[model samples]
Target: MHDDEEMLRRLRVDDLPPSMVDLNRAMRAGRRRERMGAVVAGGLAAVLALGTVVVVAATTGKNTAAPWPGAGPEGSRSPEPAPPLGNCTIDEAPVASQSRMIKIVANRSGQVFVMQDPLKSGNLLRWMDGRQERIDGVPTGDGYGTAAAVNGSGAFVGASGYKPAWVYRDGTFTVLPLPPDVSAMSMVGINERGDLIGTAFYWDGRDDTRAVLWPASQQGTPVLLATPAGWSSEAMDIADDGTVVGYLSHRTDNGPVDITPMAWGLDGSARRLPVPAGWTPARAGKRGPYPIAIAGDWVVGAGARWNLRTGTAEVVEGLMPMKVDKYGRLFGNVPLSVPDNGSTSGRPAVWVNGDVQPLPIYPDRPEGTLFSVSLDGRRITGTSYVTSGAFGTATWTCGR
Candidate 1:
């Protein structure tokens, strides 16, 4: 690897921590914008049926092609009016105060979910129809609660208090059942089918955990995914088709955490996908470069996609993927940085047909991170940090 690439890889790997607490806090530094406590898979777009708002044609019963008073021909029509100039701007108010950090931003269909004061506020805010509503009375669990994932039906899953995992559906909270020997669990991703995937950890002072899958109907037996001996696994993202992706971390004889990529089938069968050639463990874990969004033919990571059938990999030259829309387009910020309050800021960019285009920045909010994009790729949400060091949850829309 080139010295620069190697250095970048080292830096990314070093930022990865196995603990969910530290990882959640670090998200403010431009990490994966998944649900509160889980890794991003962008599966809600598929399960939730989030269709974009379309501009319907304005039709009158009568034909209006007739030329006006000074016009030339009777059949003449003004050059078909140019397409509408879409509206794109940031939200007017910050989702939270400057003392709190907006960690998780997710969307289902057209509704936006923002976890304000993550791990501290436990406040889950939803935005729809230009208004914001907080799901009333969610357990914040000593202010350490974090949202893990949200499904299409607006159902939310996350870890709270001593149980470490819970689900909120229809305005009620249900504690997820844990294994006989497991004391702690971290719920991460939930598929449209309502199947939950996460990690089950024990309180026995061992760093061992197993990837687990729970059915939505709460009917079938919970599936505990098998991991290689001496390795601990955490289930991160789940696709609509029941595919699960996450990482495996194990200790070396001398002492260092080594990580690898893992995937599982709906039947609980497990397999390890090869990390892209020359990509080190750190360049491809927790935050990505590992498959987070899976569809019929593609498994996508931060800046790369692998074809399931041909097993070929295509890399986007210079984009770090944060989330993928239903169309398989990657959303993330570019490596380019701008100065903001004595620190560098990144420009949000999207990859379409492998070409990079930076998203428009609102004049009021000079620098922001783009985390969650609507399934249609029309709406996006993230935290915009102002020059004054104050940040708030923000959303942008095009073609609205």
Candidate 2:
């Protein structure tokens, strides 16, 4: 296996504490099992199975320096576009944990934020009223459950590694219901009305996955969103009006053939978002144009931004977009590549009126990524790493 693929497999499939020897053994065992399955199938199915493996490996690799999808609330709201970022100040927000923060999300008002520590302990920390407290209701196990998105009322939704997807509200946890023949599900984004969007995986092993919507009532069954016949879909973010945005990828015996941004309306109709002329997947760091967040008529992704009203997309140069607030301010990171060492670092930044304004980084914690931006464009939260390789959650409060 290639070095990157090997690293991704270890990170995604194995949750046990790191041990090089044990990880190697586990990889070998996994390969042996795949080989035996191929022998048992012994035909077209075998080829397709191998292709699916490749797709999973490619998609599962985590980009630590890029902002995760659904990092902040993007429910339907009037655009309160802010002026281009000007002179601002920066400071570190206090947190209760010393472990690495895996994900951070904020409510529409930015008054409440949730941070998850997935490395050392799987605890969800809620920051409000200038203090931090542990959220008590999320179920935990061997591995950490992801805290995907939160709404204005402080209700949040997420999925666990060993348990079903759930929503925590009013100091209680409620498990989301799954559709028939689906064994596993994950909730990624929730809107103001309590509508939830996520993905459902099948049990038949055809590698079938579909984007699903769970209504606000919590008792209603999830509705499967529409997709093309041979393609698979995953919903990343949902708007207050029930619009969902994500990506669709089609795979074959060779591998993933195409990946493009897509959206579903309130009626469950799928519409393909146009890409910039002459742009291709190879131009997007081999990941294609994956939409991470949607607000109003705008959808922002790694290196592309599309306007749903005009049906046009423009290239977002030098920015891996993480969050787009209702005010149209774009928050992201500029990845700095080190050619000699083949490593990459990021500088936290925001785009104002198509101009890039780089945020200040502390001398002690120089490398970091921006995860959540306040609706008013005043506060941004992310993780910063020290020279010793330890990281902590921080928030940068900016002002005029």
Candidate 3:
């Protein structure tokens, strides 16, 4: 096995927090899927050149890639017109093509941002009004640098290896302060109010990971979110209204277990998000459904949406939801297939009222994945796999 794959395997089997485990899994899965897609596409092209009719037998059982209770087939049909948001159109976004891997991280207002080669030392690119700029001077070294979340104002936050969490605004990098005695930290999301949220921990021979926040007014000191004893928390995303969403997990003799979705109010009070019926941490192996984004009263993650106000959870099934728009539309990807090994090949799609709408892909690039969606659900950004087996950044715009 390659070094990176081995490292990811160790991380999942060992003591990393649930959120970190999820991240590693996502990275590994993406790499594997892309490679596999390229091979399959190449082989199909060779077969077609010879005009051979290929008949592959189907192995039937419980398809792990089966759509959620009501979802349609992957790429089964064109997306239905989204009311109010209107019909959608797609266009290729400008990106540095030098990187082998590209990831669209966030879309806010009219600005769309991407990370080129995010798993390694990477570059941050931003686009607005037909102009693209590669933001320079982000910290890098032994660890990867990434911009996890961005707000409407274009200010972004993220972390690098062993470095304190930092925010970038107006071409300046502001390293966020850590609490006393904390050894390392990383920021994941920044709100319109400049409140930043992420995970912080120590390397002092203790398994301590906690969700922390740095208010816009006081960038020097971070406030640690409350967690029950024996529990560790990792903040994933913060809504503009100052609500933070993430997960809580505790380490057991075997590993981390009992991951529970959680949300924190603007006043710094933490509340547990409702879990879907029949959901169990063991089903996913030491991890529970965790919220990846919060818009208004909706907390979305793990193919489920939880209403903070109604205290109800709805499972969207088959979707690996990434972001939720204010209209309650969920934007993410669904698995095209799940191999016996459990890895999935995903196609970019959106779920409206429980119906999966496959996004339009470039005529030449058949594979893609969805990432960030604008609050209005009009503009979305992700990666498009080209014929050569490489992928590039892409964006889609929808309107009435």
lDDT of 1 by residue, 84-138 (tens): 3245555633344344344464644435454643433556665444555676566
| lDDT, model 2 | 0.60
> What's the distance in Å from true for residue 361, model 1?
0.8
Better of 1 and 3 by lDDT: 3
Query: How many clashes show up per model?
Result: 6, 0, 0
Each candidate structure's TM-score, on Cα atoms with residue i matched to residue i, is 0.66, 0.73, 0.73
Off by over 4 Å in 3: 1-86, 94-99, 114-124, 139-144, 253-256, 281-286, 339-341, 386-388
Could you give me the TM-score of model 1 versus the true structure? 0.66
Candidate 1 residue pairs in backbone clash: 36-147, 37-147, 37-148, 50-109, 289-302, 302-321
Quantify all predictions' global Cα lDDT against the true fold.
0.53, 0.60, 0.60
Steric clash pairs (candidate 3): none
Could you arrange the candidates by lDDT from highest to lowest?
A: 3, 2, 1
What tens-digit string does per-residue lDDT give for candidate 3 at 63-100?
A: 01112211233442122333455667777765444345
How large is the C-alpha RMSD of every model relative to the true structure?
Answer: 15.6, 13.5, 12.1
**1-400 per-residue lDDT for model 2 (tens digits):** 6432332221221211111111133432353233212121001110000001000001112211111122345432223345666676666655543543245666654567776644336668777778777876577632466567788777888766634778888888787777788756656788889898887766476565688998776446888887657666778888877779987655545443455567777665566555554444444354566688877666787566765543445555556677776656678766644445544566677876567787887777776766566666787777666535566556777776
